[model samples]
Target: MPRYGFIAIDDRGREYRAVDEAMSEAALEGRLRKAGHWVAKAWEIRPMLQKGGLFGGSIRVPTRPLTEFFLQLSMQLKAGIPVLTALSGEAGESPHPGLKRVVQDLSERVQSGQTLSEAMAAHPKAFPRVVVNLTKAGEASGNLAETCNRIRLYMEWQERIMADMRQALTYPAFVLVCALAFVFIVFTLLIPRFAKLLAELNVPLPLLTQIMMRTSDFFVHNWAGVLGGVAATWAGLHFGTRLSPGFALLVDRAKLKIPVIGGLWCMIGMARFAQNLGVMYGAGIALPEALGMVAGLTGNRVLEKSITELRQAVTEGRQMHSVMGSHPIFSKLVSQMIAVGETTGSLATALENVSDYYNEVLPRQIKRMFSLLEPLMIVGLVGFVGMVALSIFLPIVSLLNIR
Candidate 1:
């Protein structure tokens, strides 16, 4: 749609600038006159930069600034400021150069009479799918402000979970890196020197000492190969997921079945599924359509398949919770809450409760995993050091005895 920016005068002789979409100036003037306004100025906005920043068409706006944008837009809308005005203000308020540019574009687009959600849809990276869908619902329900505020909360919750996951992994990751570095030093430098000395002595080597020498030689010679293999394997899996659905599904299912971490991953998926499902359902989107909205959000193909099943059941006139029993990915508590919600015609609230339950559970699970990992890492480190100590010391003691 072609949008035109315009200055118009109301019956009170007050002037205001706005954007409206129309086929022509005549059409736009006709519409404005119906609202008791005279067109004073108008011009077409052909945006050159489009949806993103100077870097590229796909600008990655940071979460904090994005959250701020949503919050401020909601507050401004709630205060009765027009969408274009609020957007213009946002363009100015944002410190992020990319966000500022995007907001400026959004303001111009809205002025051209595109809805806020439509403007957002243009920047998929800057505006998330969930946010765009919710905004659409809010526009339909005339609850855009409240919905945007809710979107802010949802995003904040997501960020918190991610931050917790990072924090939980930090100590374990540090330990693993340190252990690997120490092992490399011992294998490549210390062990090689000791092996050379033991070789010069021409004495019989212990079995452990021989094994250590071989392992050290492999590390020294094939370290680059090991790193290349790791990188290649990771790349293969990462691209395979995007290129082949079956492979992706297989991997995702395996992820969900991992002994201790698997259950936690499933819970994370469940929480996200419920939260998104609740938002769409509460937005007055039909059950089946709402189910579709949440399909790929679970981050697990197993759970994604479950969403498909739920959608099918809803379409087939079957209760969704009834199908839940068939999918172990969903817990009994979730099924029961959804069942009650379906019966009460408040499925949205039920799903929100389900989400709430898991949101609380995830952090505790992460902490528990971290606590367990600490001791395991310590024990593994001690065992590794012991083996290395014995490998180097065993032959020395034997040589001393021979003398």
Candidate 2:
């Protein structure tokens, strides 16, 4: 479908201008007439390439700010403020230039007679399919305020989980980087000087020292090859994920089997799925449609495949809990609860409960992993430093004893 920009006069004699997607200019004009607007003019709008600014590219508005924007918008709507007023106020007050641009665009579209959902759909980067669908559902159900609230809560929850995961990984990442820097310094700079001194003394080296020196020499001579190999491996994996769905699926499945992080990944996926599905279902979205929308939120190919299967089964009039139980992604407890919810006619509540369960347990699991990781990393760092020190000093001590 192509977008057409139009100018029209509404039944109240107010002129409106908007860009809308339609099959042709005639179709867009017909839509405007049907909605009690007299179309003045309509033209197809083509996309233009935006040039990068001094910052090198477009500014990306982060999710936390979006969450706050929606939270405020929802409150304003709940207080009986008009959509245009809420949007204009938000755009005016927003500190993020990217968000201000999006909100201002949305306000203009809405003023031009487009629905809020339609306006948001134009900016998919800022407002995803799930948000657009929920907004559409709210428009249909006359509950846009509640829908906005749900979107805010969902984004806030997701941001918090991501923040926690990042925090948990911070110490381990720092330790790994420090260890790599230490090894690089020793191999490229420190070890060679020690090796030269040992050679001048003409003493027999210990097996460990000889091995370390040989390893350092190899690295010093082949650092280019080592760096190129690392870069090639990273590039290959990055492209593989983008180009091959099967490879991506295998990688996602393997991610769930990694020792401490795997369980956290599963929990995060489940929580997101449950929360999104619950909100959409509660807002009166059909099960199949809700399942289809929620599938994209998982960010894992394996879980997405299972959800797609579940959606197909539901479309065929099969019991959702029964179909879901066949997938390992849904735990036994979750399956049982979903079945009970379906039987009792409260599936949304059941999903919300599942989400709450994960939200509570996820933090504890992250904390436990961090507790174990800290000590393990410290011990590894100490052991590595001790080995390097021994390799360098033991030879010098032997030469001293001989003197």
Candidate 3:
């Protein structure tokens, strides 16, 4: 649908200006009028030239602001404020420009006789599919405030998990950067000087020194090729993941099998799926529908495929726990718990307990892995620099003895 820029006067005598998508000018005017606004003027909007293709057009609103928005909206709705009033207040009070714009647009949409979920569907960036679906469910069940609180809690949990992952990687990333710098200095500066001195002395070089010199020479002469190869490899992977679903699936599968971080990745995915399923289920979404949403939340194609299969099984009237038990992606404990939940008709609580287990385990696992990683990285760095120094000095000592 084409977007339109419109000027309209509301029933309250306030003029509103914004862009909205509609089929035509008539539709735009009709929508505004139905929203209790008199259309002053409306015109089609041509999209602005985006700087980056496919990825660059929109500003990224941070998760914190969004979480806070949901939380506040929940509180307001719980306090019996009307949806439109809560949205307008949120838009007016928000400090985030992107969020404020989204809220303002949502408010206008709501004022125009659209439901909160319908308004949110227009802004997928600010309101994800899960949020929109849950909101719709809440609206249907007349429990939108409770759903909003669930969304808020999910966002907060997601944010904290991401923060923990970043923190765990920070020290290792710093160490790797320092090690790379040390290697670069040794190869580009120190090794060349040693090579020149050895050449001047006209002595036979040791195997270690010869190898070091040759490696340094390769880097010094072919640095552009090295950098280009790295860049090309990254670009290839980036585009491949975007363009090929099978390749992306393969990559995601590989991520689950990676050395130290694989378990962490798997745990995180499971945790998110469980949490999403629990929240959506608690909000009164059907099991199969919640499973479908959880599939998307897993963020891993392997798990997503399994979850999708489980959804299909459920849709076919099969037992969910039985199907899930057949999948290796789910643990025996999880399967049993889910079976119990199924038996007791409390799958939401079971899933929440599963999510809590993963959430608790993930942080400790990350910390332990990084603790081991730091010492291993330190040892490797020291060993590498020591070997390089020995390679250079042994040749010098041998030349002196010959003299």
Candidate 4:
């Protein structure tokens, strides 16, 4: 389907402009009319800048962490409790200030007759597109309770997978931070004190020790510059993603090329895509629509582009398996499973199976990767510290032998 940017009016001549999805210009016009908007002008916009900026900030606000909130929401909806009442309950129990306030507002909106999906869409910063789409599908299918349950389960899986990956990286990350701190201590405090004593004694330092002294002095003198460089680098990456889609794609591509971490990163993204797509499909979303919704879940630009291309191919009546097979990023197993699902009309189940498989495999893989990384990091840091110590002490030993 083609995306169009349309400026339109209602029967009473109220004007509005927005971007919409449709198969053609004529189709979009029909849709607008059906929605009670009379089309005045319509045109397609080039998707050159396809994605939004870095989501929020470094402190990740967990959007769907409260597993119990969803569970209760499902139970309430199942018991014929109104959507507003359910949202209010969720709001009352949510501990996070941001989420609590948003839920409260959402409850008010729902009470005012907006659908749950509509209420949620108002908070795009809080709710992901997949969640919003699932809510809509649930409302359309009259199975809000089941949809909420599925979404809750999906989010639980996501959080667990992420927690596992974070755990795997935790030890290595801590080691790296400690290693940097050790280096800083040596350069700033220990080395300078040693240099003072050596200067007082008028001892000629070894070449390695001389080099270390010079490096430490430079670092000590230019500490502010180092901090500024780090800050600048972060800002550049942040604004670059916001201002340039091409640059963002390059960064995302680089992420996939990273060493051991890269593979795990890719797996995490694939799991998210599979799980969200499965949930949508199971909730009776059409294949193309499901693909569109799933695209938002992948944090990588290259993968998002692949999904967009896949959606286009499917829109043209191309086989899902063939479209996906053309992309080298997708594994043979995933492609084959999709093929099987398409043939048997069970893509939902196939997607669910893929999600389940990764849910089981990724945590274990992440743990193993971390376990290997920790020792390697410790050994490297110790070797570095030992070399520096030896370089400084060996010259003293030589001077003693001369005496």
Give the candidate number with the greatest lDDT: 3
Count of clashing residue pairs in every prediction: 1, 0, 1, 0
Candidate 3, residues 2-114: lDDT per residue as tens digits? 76667788999998667688999998888778878899877653332111213543245689999999999999999999998999899899999888877876776666556
Question: lDDT per residue, candidate 4, 69-117, as tens digits?
Answer: 6788899999999787778788888877766766765665555446888
Q: Pick the candidate with the highest TM-score.
A: 1
Q: In candidate 1, what are the lDDT values of residues 139-188, reduced to their tens digit?
A: 99998888888888778888889899999999999999999889989999
Residue 289 lDDT in model 1?
83
Q: Of the candidates numbered 2 and 4, which has the greater lDDT value?
A: 2
Q: For model 4, what is the error of residue 366's alpha carbon versus the real structure, in angstroms, after optimal superposition?
A: 1.4
lDDT of 1 at 390: 97
- Candidate 1: C-alpha lDDT: 0.85
| Pairwise TM-score winner, candidates 1 and 4 | 1
Q: For model 3, give the RMSD to the true fold.
A: 4.8
lDDT value, residue 34 of candidate 4: 91
Q: Please provide the root mean square deviation of candidate 2 (C-alpha atoms, Å).
A: 5.0
Residue 222, candidate 3: alpha-carbon lDDT:
99
Model 4 stretches with alpha carbons more than 4 Å out: 1-66, 82-104
* Cα RMSD to the true fold for all candidates: 4.7, 5.0, 4.8, 9.9
